[model samples]
Target: MKIPITAFEKEPLKDHCGIVAAFSTDDYPFFETGLKGLRILQTRGYDGAGFCAITKFGKTKTYKGIGMVNEVFSDGKRKNFASFPAQQWVYQVRYGTQGIVNDANVQPVLLKHRDGDWFCVAHNGQFAKDRNKREEKLSDTVLFAQELARSREASWDERIVTLLQSKRGAWSLVIATKNGLYLARDPLGIRPLTYGHLIDKKSGELIFCVASETGALEQMGVTDFFEMLPGTIARYNDQGLHILHQDKPHQTALCVFENIYIQHGAGRAHLPRKGNRQINRSPTIDDVRRKSGKILAREAPIKKSDADIIIGVPGTGIEGGMSFARAVNIPYFQAITDIWDEPYEQRTFMSAKISDIYQKVLDHFHFDAASLKDRSVVLVDDSIVRGNITKGLVYLLKKFYNVHAVHLRILCPPIDKPCHLGVNTRSAKELIAARLSGNIEKISKALGANSLAFLSVSGLKEAMYTPKNKNGFCTGCMSGEQYPINEFGEPLAHRRKKATQIFLYDNVTNPAPILL
Candidate 1:
């Protein structure tokens, strides 16, 4: 049977959803605190937002909408939603990497079990098993919650572990039940999950927080946070956090793209000190990007004479661009600025339609033509996926801004393979690098740049390596290397059938015309 494709499946690379949950010992409502954390993690996704809270009255309260975090929890709805007295909550900002973007796909998905127990789940990565036609209409997170709720396991923790261990793919999940909050990460560590604690000043009570990124925890005044180890499941309750189960160590395959593009630069990764897991030091994403930039300069050097000014793509590329300029001894200019007149901060990469993506580019980006006119330019970006945005920018520079030359430098290696783990790049055919057979010249010409260069896989590894992250990274998208674990998160030797093609659905009910 042919399955429908999703808008996300058409995009080159889309952002992953963000999940944040908090458990407070105090009686006060914790949904507000979870919302604040979700705001800080908004960059991870913006397709939709929602939260599920377990009220002090032993009731489940959920509110969701198809928009950003603030939009979902708008001013009019805030008073009523915040009035509830909740001690545990789970929140999600979605990008719908697996399902169509709509109200049905918005998370934290609240479901009731056969035993009449209600649970909510918010997930941050794609579930590999959900690619089949049977699950096409539902988002992976929703399907996961459904499976969990249907499980015959006597306890919530047992149900969570049983369901997660039996599946594959990248996931960092936060589940809320009347009993407490539960958190789990995939065995390969393909997605990021961090947990931290903050002290509630008034009640002198300790609050436990779990988030997809450290930035969210930091927003709640949490200075020290611990990265959840691979194949781990833990629970947060009135007694405090407890590790229920942890799978034996496997080759670590943390998603490398987090540091390169997805994560907020302000977020920090804790590194063990002197090989001691008990002692750790932290490095912000900004530091890693700058270091990567410095290394990229050495790997693909562009002298001052070759380019007059270096311009980093706004938002993610700024840090690396600045460091690249400093490393090359060239002047750096903020030539690209965002046009605030747009209704919302629309990310071009997040748009499903090519026309919509291009329109957003025209509406959102503004070039300082005065400073950039008639000058050689060094354009730095985090990565070049399908090359649409890069090509558009290059076209604007040469056609409108009249730049003399455009030299493009990318901090990430050429993504030749689709990321099956979490990111929405589903087919190699959609990647410019793979289509061009990894030819730098052909890729450069395709992007309308005079020259283009990408950081090597080894260079990326060197830049991202930290003591705590010594296990390794998942470069499957760049190198086409097989993961230590298959798409189902099981050992490769026991792998299931070949990877299945993901169907595209126009909406929850109808399948799109095209079939892969």
Candidate 2:
């Protein structure tokens, strides 16, 4: 399934996967808590859902299926989940970044070591593309599991750190053993991971929950929580939480996409504190996306009369588009409407095939041709990776709807490189900005736009950054700046193509691996 860059030049960019691990002091219905946490994190991943639970009696149970969290955990399945007496739980919602979508590929990867020990893992980020070339058959999580099982380290935390140091990419992971639960983030912190607590009022006992987003913890009724520092590992057990290992971040490269599109507005993220691990003040995503819009306007203001009205793409693009319109003093209109009936509204740009993306875009959006007819329009989207939908939208407006002209504006800077941090766009060749040599006019011509401009990387940082911290986001895709821990030896595209055949090794022998 080697897709030529020309036909699939623009695939949709997807958020990284999601992970959750809960340590319960009492024999509460921990499975439901894990499911609720996964439900809140559904946005990060929708392709599949699964969970692994260990009961107080040392029995382990796991259920995984390909679909949305609710779809996978149906009413009957929920009842089954409830019947399991679990004391600790680990859950995962997966988006296939490097592996094919199948039952085995669906995660909460459980592996049984040759030594008769069992381990289960759920990961939220990606290893570097080059890291998997030699073993194209293994998914990053599965590969990490195999590597961990093979490691000689005696402690779970050391085994995890060994995996982190050996593999280079964005990994915010929760690795669970029957004994304790461990959480680790990559040194650069490209993916978000946080932990929160819900105290039992009766006994004042603490129940700790960890997830990809703080909002997921809050969904489970957690009130007090804190973000983890990059290059840190936290282990939770009967004794309570302990920071077993913490490393100084070589450079804090928190993935910007989380703030822009992945994370919900309510989640709080922060830069490293001045001298401590505690981050006192965190920025809300609502503020960051809106500020990005204002900065986009300031950086690339639309000329007067250059466009008659603004058409902001819904949900993800609207906030920035509205701010851009206001800053540019242009009339903003809700020209494009999403069809609520079409519940499967794939962000067309994220599709692997151009035809699928085009069809999805047409099905998802309907143009109000009567209002937009014969008027110049400015089209605003949050970010452009493949440029398929933007180009298609321009063609739809001008060619089909008879709009006077369409101008394209992007909120983020040009993505000229592949994201090695668990995002779906893992190859530089797939990026339109990279393909077009970063030439705006050529991109404009290709997209059939009258003109096009993008917010500069510095401008994007300015908009997203608080006055207190200027550079806290990962713009690795835009700047091609290597993160501190890239282990270069393999090719991602080659391995991704072969992933299905090799990575599903456990599916044949055991639907679930590493069952202790």
Candidate 3:
């Protein structure tokens, strides 16, 4: 029997990557544990997956492919890798925000030092600088690994610290070498990284694990964990985990988008409080999203008569939509359902071509035309990057679904600048908000919505941290402000000239420019 498939159009913002690493004192096999952790953090990336394993004898093996974790490390392949006993493991799921999305770019990138020692690194963020003419084809992570291998530093830990201190960008890296497992985060704290330990029940040996998110640690039954401070480099070896270097104190600029979209709902952040003594309070990403919705409702409330129901844009938007519906005293409905395509569910944002993105939207998302017929809908979504998907969904509701009206509510503030820290949106021209000068009315009209509103910058901060807390966030994309650091790994000043240089660089070098 043949089934007809309706075609629709949509797109989304893309995340960077996720990394996981494990080291055991007793030389226990950690291949399976690493795979499990990668699965838990797969939402951060899905374009490719790979892992590198180090045996007790210092022999290293690496496997990677351009697919999801399960597809790359299938049951048969897992068995093959498990046959080789390994004491240390590192895995990565990549979204390819930088360089080409091919086999060569896949991470857990293994490189040989000039001295003949081999090391593998899995990275979770993008570099701010462009590759030189010689290294144009290499991804940032691969180039980083090459540099580490060729460095003149006396030790691997010293090489990592020296290289990272000179580079600009948001990176959370897990490096595996014959000596030990090394983990590092960028000075700005623009990305997330956490490390934890679990005791083996039988051997009573300690196992150390590090990941871009805490959820992966939880999946491995690790309850006691600590978020790595910004600019810190640490290593886990036979002796134990030790801090190799900690960069001088700087203004922390954690990426706000992690709370808004990139991170999983279960992910949490430990916000530091200000008082006589510092105390950290944790808040789930889900809670922050829901609170953003509530704050949005207060800022721009839609009447019940105007909006009969609220529909979340699926996945990340669901939490915010539920809270928005409750705040407005309107009924919430799962009017949009995802049509899973077995093992190969396509992400529209990850598509390189606009045509492919639109096709994937039709293949993956199904709208309930019958339920939404002639009903006014308030569509809630995380953020509108290029506005292709938001515009397509709005047009479908009115033209095909026969919806009366669509009042679009975004959970975050209007993004008017490109993210230099790790997100895929690298050019400001591609951002609808940036194109429209952050004008609400114009953006709403462009999206074909009855009205549009975004949660304010202050509201977003309130939702993530306490009013009295001293936590800092990188709102450069929203406010067109200077990032904590510039592309040269120097502290950024509030100079318009520097901003202009960055904008010019992006326009000239960006390979994937969205055309409206």
Query: What is the Å distance of residue 385 in model 2 from its true position?
Result: 1.3
Clashing pairs in 1: 4-503, 4-504, 5-503, 5-504, 5-505, 6-504, 168-488, 168-489
Tens-digit per-residue lDDT, 240-293, candidate 3: 878898777666788888888777688675343222012124778898899989
TM-score of 3: 0.87
Off by over 4 Å in 1: 1-11, 130-135, 270-280, 345-362, 466-471, 485-516
Q: Give per-model TM-scores.
A: 0.87, 0.84, 0.87
lDDT per residue as tens, model 2, 1-516 = 111121122334666588888887655567776788888777777678899987665667899998778778888889987857666788998887776767777889988755666778999888776632564655767777887888887767777766677666778888777668888887777787888788767657577888888778888878776777788887888888888778864547677777766776677653444333353356667677778788777766767666789878766677778888999999999999765542342333455565565565566677898888988888877777777767667777766688877777777777787665677776677788789887765666777777677777667677666666555666667643333344352323311111111000111112111101
By how many angstroms RMSD does model 2 differ from the true structure?
A: 10.9
lDDT scores in order: 0.74, 0.71, 0.75
Q: Indicate the worst ten consecutive residues by lDDT in candidate 1.
A: 503-512
| Model 3 misplacement above 4 A | 1-12, 130-135, 270-281, 343-362, 468-471, 495-516
- Can you rank all candidates by lDDT, best first? 3, 1, 2
RMSD of 1: 8.4
Candidate 1 or 3, higher lDDT? Answer: 3
